[model samples]
Target: MSGDASHRPLDLRSDTVTRPDETMRAAMAAAEVGDDILDGDPTVRALEEKAAEILGTEATLWVPSGTMGNLIALTVHLRPGDRFLAPALAHVVEFELGGWASFAGGVPHALPWSAGPGRVSPASVRASVPPSQPYDALRDRLLCLENTHNAAGGTVTGPGEHRAVTATAKEAGLLVHLDGARIWNAAVSLDVQPAELTWGVDSVLACLSKGLCAPMGSVLGGSAEFVRAARRLRKMVGGAVRQGGVMAAAGLVALSRIELLRNDHSNARVLASGLRDLGWEAASPETNIVLARVTDAERRVSELHRMGILATTISGAVRFVTHADLSEKDIQEVIWRISSMSP
Candidate 1:
């Protein structure tokens, strides 16, 4: 059965697998273009404008990746030798290869968030920023956060928590940057408009490639002056692309189809519930990613591969992300395969 099943492809690796659908392909094929580096590409400009409006910001810039978008935003917000703060599990702190230190020339003060689901408390922020002995003078230049925090099984931080955190950051005169790679999923799961969650944030970087199904792109949004500065930082980091509208066309389709993300979140919950039923421990997913723990995680991953299911094991936890292309049937099949596995 496993051999025969190998002929079928049920990729649950990550939402990043979602390819451009027919409409996206059509848009890309017909997209008008210009030298975005010199004279901004019209399609890229439209996508940036749409993203800015959605994020409730004054302006936006299109970048090639969420990493680039975040790096540019951080560099724009902080100068060399400055310091930024975030939860220890934040993508920029844990996953971005220390770009904040290397590219932005800033130090990271990774404060601990709530353990299981990984939430940062305002008190933690306050304590992390208060002057300590030795008088090191580590000024807090920026506060970074992630929505539907990836390493936390896509947990959604409520708007109240967001406001409290941002309020603290603002009171301290620190600029806040949101790593909203899955902001759309967070909004859908929390049943709030995206803008409401981002209203207090100084700047935001959201990815078009993740849950939105764009082939590749991310938008950095903030005040007009901030975005202008980020644009220069993007070019300085070699992120400027010529005639990039081909990718931006797919991003347009992603924005128009973003409402469907609720379906992905629903499937994620279903997947987590099923894993629980199989006696596998899974975090309660509030968005489109689920984290499950299996005994001898490395061995379990190999077994899953034999069953033709793919997932990532992060520190003994396997991550399963739902995407637009995965059907309910595919989700069920994934659950069934896991059920048959013995630790």
Candidate 2:
């Protein structure tokens, strides 16, 4: 954050931009590793156990990305003709490449909640399925919920809301999976453990890289048998890793930095308030992501980069993400840069 501060680009592009610091690198270098495929890597096992403990699941498996983790959960829950349900704008359906249909052979059914875009009520979820169906019918079978929903401006689904939806799914005999890639942010913002928001769900996935600042990997946690099946599915999808403890050592450090996420949430709120003060309408972020209304978002993002303030164009708005790598000085610099811009 010092020395040539003016030359540094305010990279509010995404949390994924963060690079591992010295402590993480040191852990990675000092990791005890082995062939993870044949003989499991000791550090990877430790990290997986830590992830399971954090998520309050029976077991956990380390995977390559959030997409693969979610996909594995999907394929494990639904079959070829089964119907899967999720919020209309969920990353699993929108961002991930039709993996349910492509890999799992399941069909997708989008259900939007009455409260807003990223929520679904018990009644609504119940209504999405049939009251009575014939034996020949292939009915809705799975539900996936995204906390701190990406396209919905990172809005959180509290434990109550999460339970409301999941309760309905349970009544309908439907399995549930949580796309909790940003659950750490939600937990920090809500002042609750991540496991509290995930109760009753069959499976859950959280990323180690985003906001957590690990260079790579995501962890999927669920019942012991669910994780065992996921491991085979992971291997089938070419996500297997040997000597993975090297990267997992960084994840071990990432878990230790959970409390630090509050800073990103704080920075996000500050950035949102600053944008509003400067006349751009920005959503007050509940977590680390800020979605702001801007004229010509593509042009604004380009100009922001020109001014050394980096962002992304999302849903016709300029998206600014706060991360562990961004310091308070960086936030102020970004605000100054934005205030100086015409857009």
Candidate 3:
């Protein structure tokens, strides 16, 4: 969403578009790095420990991307040809390029959002589990959940709801994996610790490159045994990095500023409120992502792009994500520009 040196487009596509601030850049430059796979990068280990503590897990492994983190979790949890359940339109279902099927060798069974947008009911999950069937039936091995679910305009599943769903899966003998890429936002919005929402899940992945605004990295956390296994799989997938502390250092800085996500959430609410005032059906955002229903998402998005506001379409809705790089003034300007658009 860059225009020129003088006119930078207001990018609302996703939080991933955020650039590392000077603090992050300085940390990266001064990072003490080493061979992550051979000798173990000291800073990478520090990040893993910090993330694990935040998520209340026994251990954690640093991966190059959230997709890779999810893949590693899938590989460890599912055997080849096993089936796993995820909410329909979940990032692992709609995004991730079918890595669950092709790479992880697991079947994806999409659960309807019966509880609400981007949420699945506990009863629905219980019903999805096959009865003590013959050996030929595909085994359901894992349940994947997303907090502040992306495609649903960043709707949050509260700690109680999270426990209910995961408890159901666990009772049915399924391991749970939480795609907690935006868990910090959810925590800030709910006024709870990030660990509260992750208590019942066996493993969770949190991204540093998204709202936290680190350069690039995600951490997967679980039991010491689970992470020990994931470390091997991470290396197998060519994710082994030597001197990875440069990025992990930025992650440390990002973690320190986790509370700052409240600003992004506040800005998103303002953006949605403005869109609603313009006669668009914009839902009140629960976090930093806003979804406005439109007759033609592609056309609306294109129009916005031309007006120097970058946006994307998700499930026939215009998607806007607020992030660290955006300010309250930028939100106001976006509303003004959209209001001036031709009908």
Tell me the tens digit of each residue's lDDT in model 1 across 1-343. 3446554767777899999988899999999999999888999999998988888999999999999988888888888878898877788888889888888899998878753365788888887776543556766789998887888788878888899989988887789999999999888888888888797887898899988899898999999999889988888989899999999999999998778998898888899999988888986688888888877777777788877788877757888889998988788888877777764
- List per-candidate RMSD values in Å: 1.8, 1.9, 2.2
lDDT (10s digit) by residue, model 3, range 18-106: 99988889999999999998889999999999999999999999999999999999989989899999998999878998888877899
Model 3 residue runs over 4 Å out of place are: 1-7
Name the top TM-score candidate. 3
Full-model lDDT for every candidate: 0.85, 0.90, 0.92
Deviation in angstroms for 265 in model 1?
1.1
Give each model a TM-score.
0.95, 0.96, 0.97
Off by over 4 Å in 2: 1-7, 134-137
Residue pairs clashing, model 2: none
| Deviation of model 1 at 36, angstroms | 1.2
Clashes of each: 0, 0, 0
What count of clashes does model 2 give? Answer: 0
RMSD of 1: 1.8
> How big is the positional error of residue 25 in model 1, measured in Å on the Cα after superposition?
0.2
- Candidate of highest lDDT: 3
As a whole number from 0 to 100, the lDDT of residue 217 in candidate 2 is 96
